[model samples]
Every structure is written in structure tokens, then in C-alpha cells.
Target: MKINYLELKRVTAMHAHEIQQAVNHVVNSGWYLQGEAVGTFEAEYAKYCGAQHCVGCANGLDALTLTFRTLITLGRMGEGDEVIVPANTYIASILSVTENRLTPVLVEPRLNTFQIDDRLIEQAITPRTRAILVVNLYGRNALTDTIIRLCTKYNLQLVIDNAQGHGLSLPHGTLHSAALPSPSVVCHSFYPGKNLGALGDGGAITTDDETLATLFRTIANYGSSRKYVFDYCGRNSRLDEIQAAVLSVKLKYLDADNALRRNAAQRLIGEVSNPLITMPSAEYCHDNVFHIFPVLVKSPDTLQRHLQDHGIGTMRHYPIPPHQQACYQAWAALHLPITEQIHREEVSIPCNQTLTTEELTHIIFAMNSYDK
Candidate 1:
């Protein structure tokens, strides 16, 4: 009874027939790039997310970079501007800001929720601060009401790094807009392992701002607003027809799959009563799609070895903090205790939609038995 960290094969098997049909349809269409499939998926996804527009891109990182570059093109932001981001987020979130020549102000995340501490946001804002990029880490919603108010008060752009948080919704009041209930620009990933994955790498940006949407679309397509008419010196980042077709089929089932993940996480939280392990609160579970069920333990390496001994696979969402990475040598001396602690102790367990009752119980038992 080997329980893999994520049974991607099983995930594809669940919708094999439909996925194949969609792939076949794209293959037979004779039109690949900038085709109908991509257009259709963009519209459907925008409607699903309650956004006015969606621009599909090559991958999650591209989606993020394009959003910032597009904003720069629109004169909403400029190079060297500061963008506040969580110090605990994946490197991609910080990379996007730096790639656009913007400064990334790393703020600490709250230990309990693994989200940015909104209380610390205003303190970090300087006159050069132009935006805030909140990553909904591990599929949890970081779109807090206080963050919304702060953005409005500061006249800053609100960008969402939603790569791991597909199908994650927030309460109505948490968002400012009644129509969309999301940020001005939200980026998504479909990197074969995400909650809403495609067959290959894929991503999109959702926004209600028409100007930004149009700019992103133009910028993603080699900066061409029309054929051979280059706009703002962009790159080739369009979401190909094949991945778009695959995503369209999978998007329909995202919510249902997320529900299963939530249930599995609840089971782990309820049954695993080990004193050494600290699970995220069930109260905030509903706001998360459980892309990764991370448990904080004193000895992550020892626990990972124990799970492997039991034929139970696991992973670390991130083992190194971004500030400590070799690439960011200048930030090596910066101290972010909470982020460093999370990186040291966090271990991601199997909590996908395909886990069975017996498999979940086996996990709980193994976890409870780990003392070191």
C-alpha cells in the first residue's frame, strides 16, 4: 500500500477519456497557436472566476511577470518601484517583481495561517512603494478585508500570486468588489501539479480592469497589439492551444476536486493527535483548497524519514527561504525568523483528492507514531 505524495497518474485517470477527447479535438483543428481553443478557455475561466477578462500565458511565472510589465506599460508602475511581498512565499512571487526591475520588500508571514501579517504591511510602505503582491500560499486565501482597505488607502495596486490557490474563494466582505470579489490582477498556474492543472505548463491572469487586461494580452503576444505592430517590447508567452484545451476540461471539475482535498485534510487534522505536530487550524480550512497539507514539526527530516520507512511518500513545499538563497546574496544578512522557522520545520504530506479512507487512516497512524 504505497501512498505517493501526489498520485498525478490517478488524477489524469479520473478524467482520461474527457481529456483525450479534448486533446484530439485540438490536434484535429489544424490551428494551434492563437486559436479558438485558447479563446474559449479564456472566456470560460474568466466567467468561472467572476472576472471580466482572462489572458492565458505560457506558465505561472509568465502570468505574473506579464501582469507587472503590462502595468509598467500602462504607466501604472515603473522600474525601481517597490512591491511588498511575503517573505515566506515561493521564489516565483519575488522573482516576478525583481524581473520587472521592481524592488521586492519582503514582509514576515504569520505563523498560524502562513499568510502575510497585514499589521506589518503599512509599516513597510515607503513613498516608492507602488504595489503589494500577496501570494495565497498552500491554497489558502490571503485576500483579507484589512489588506483591501490598506491598498485603497495607499493607492497601491493589488496583485495576487494565486499559483497554488485555484478554486480558492474568500468571503464576500473580504473583497472590495461585489462583482468580482478578487484582486485587480490575479495569476494562476496549471503546472501539472496545481489544483487546476493542465497537461503541460499553463497559466492565466484574471482582472476586471479592461486596460490592464488588454495590455497583458498584447504584451504576452510579443508586444504586438496587432500583426507586426509591436507595442511595449514584450515576450512570447501565449498559452498554446493544446494546454488551453486540456485546462478547459479540467476547470469544470476543480471545485469538486478541491472539496475532496478539504475533506481529506479535515480527516488528518481530526485524527492525527501527535503532540510534536502542529496542523493548520480547521477554522481557516474552508478558505483553502488544500493544495498542500503542511504540518510543522520539530524534526522535519526525521519525520520525513519515518514516513518513507512506512512506504508513505512526502515532500517539503520549500526547504529554503528566499532571502537565504545564493542568488539573493545581498539579502543573506536579512533576518526573517518566522519564515526561516517555517522552512526548517514544514513537511508536506499526501492530501490530494484521490486519497482513500484507508490510506488516510494509514497516514494518520504513521504521523501519530512519530516521536522524533
Candidate 2:
């Protein structure tokens, strides 16, 4: 009766065969760095996202940082420019804006969806505002259409931080971003446990702009295109051949796996109705892959204790909002009542794609039994 939040999909014998084939091919190919495997993986991933191009990287944080740096390289943004972001997002979201020496303006997210409150974005815009870094928290997509409209109105870039939302869009994000160009970017994290997770950390930036995509590649590879020539000071952040190969195989099943996660989430909502627990409502959003089933509950401490004692594993998406953290305190004075409340009550339940019906029921029963 012990279950961690999620178990990675089994690398069954067949999966292992594919991985072994890839590994053996890589082993003798003598072309590991930026080789055929990397190139093939990039092409396949781009096709998967419906984007014109995809550049793989070492990790999610690097993917986010490269997106920001690429904007600056294209002269779309620069130092002293400001990037608007959600206060309730993962720290990596904020770090990306700051890593590029740009200012980060934190805005409160909707309590229900935990996405940046679209209503408050326009008012936060100033002359220096260059882009909006919107995150699809847990598994939900933000009101990206509304965000696109606002970006158009303000002439700002829309950099999507989809660390927790990989196969999240399936096909929608590419189509949506393709509808508009030069002001939109959708980045994905293939970190382990993600909808498109590799065996290790990885990520990609999807965009229709060939120029921006080109620049992102340069940034991810030490600012050099020809190995010896350096375009600018960039970081070493290339996605490994082994990971890329593994990801190619995983990408094939992402959609079906996401559907499984979604189904489990629906059942959890249907079964859990304690007045103390608040389940996320997707009425306002589009698609979700349930990266985490975060719910609000009274006495988070007692709930965590009770669940843990009963062999049910649970955790907080974030116990503290980013703006309140000490490193970000210089500009953290902004009041975000909704964000604060979310931090206090939010607790993530076990909703991994690999979860079985019996396992899921065990968790639901434990949560419900707490009331009695």
C-alpha cells in the first residue's frame, strides 16, 4: 500500500530493445555530440509539436534561459527590459528572466487554475515590458489565447514556460503559436516524470521563427555554430544523444499517456468532495496532462501528516510563492492574496500516468477516510 506520487512508465522489454538499439547505434557511430541521433531526435520532436523547428537542450532551466537569450539576440529584448511572470510559478520561470539580466515583474495567478491572472496582466505592462513568461502550472494550460491577444495589443513577446506541460498541448500549442509569429515561443521540459520525460533531464524550444530557433541553437551550444567560431558568450547546454534517442521513443506514446493521466484526474475530482479539499476546475482552461494533482485542503500540515501516516504520499506544489522567497525579495512587496492562500492550502495528490485503478482508489479512500 505504499505508492510514491508517480512511477515512471515501465521500460518494458520492447522499450528496452528500442533503447538498446539506440545505445548500440550511438556506441559505434562515434558521433555522439550533435550527431545523427541528435539531429533525428530534433526533427521528430519538432514534428511532434507541429513546430517548424526544435532545439534540444541539457535541461529545462537551460531551455528557459535559451529562450530568453534568443529574444535578446534577435534584438527583440535586452537589459533593463522587463518580463512579466506569474508569482505562483516554479522558480525556474523567474530565474530565466533574471538570468538574462532582465527585470521580472511578478503578477498573482488565479487561485483556481494557478495560472497568471490574465485580468491583471494589462495593468502591469509598462514601456520596459518586453515579454510575458506564462507557465502552464501542474498540468493545465493558461488562457493562452487571451495572453496572445494581450501580447498583440502591447507589442510584447509571449514566452511560454511549459516545464510541467510537455505533451500538454499535443497539437494545439503549435497551431496556436503558428497563427501568430515573432511574438510567441513555447518551451518544453522533458525532465524525468514529465509527460514526455527522458530517462534524465532534457528540454526543447518550439517556435515557427526560423531566425529565433537558429539563435536558440547557438545559445544552447556555447554561442558557436561552426564549433570554432563563437557568436556570443553562451552556456554549454546540449541535449545528450542518449536522452534524445530515449525521448524519441517516449514521444510516440505521450498522447495516450496524457489521456490516462487526465482520466485519473477526472476520477479523483469525482470522488473527492470533502468541504476541506478544493480540487482544480478545468472549466476555464483547455487541455491538461495532470503533471500533478494539486488540491487545496484545510490544515495542510494535518492533512499531510494524516496522508503520510496512512501510507499515502503527498506534497505541496510550492509551499512558498516565488516573490516571497528571500532571493526575490527586492521586488517581492507586491500583494498577492490569492497566491498566498494557494500556498497555504495546496497539496498534490498521486495522479501519475502509471497509477493503477486499485492504487488510485487506495489514495482516494485514504483521503476520504481522513474526514471520518
By TM-score, the best candidate is: 1
Which stretch of 10 consecutive residues in model 2 shows the poorest summed lDDT?
170-179
Cα lDDT of model 2 by residue, 2-113, tens digit: 8776655552333668777877887887777788777888898888777788888998888888898889888999998999988888889889889889999878888767
Q: Work out how many backbone clashes candidate 2 has.
A: 0
Q: Give me the runs in candidate 2 sitting further than 4 Å from their true place.
A: 9-14, 170-177, 282-285
- Per-residue CA lDDT of model 1 for 98-175, tens digit only, reads 899999999999898899999899999999998989999999988787888878888889999999999877787222
C-alpha-based local distance difference test score of model 1:
0.89
Choose the strongest candidate by lDDT. Answer: 1
Question: How far off is model 2, as Cα RMSD?
Answer: 2.1
**TM-score of every model?**
0.97, 0.94
| lDDT (Cα, 0-100) at 317 in candidate 1 | 76
**Count of clashing residue pairs in every prediction:** 0, 0
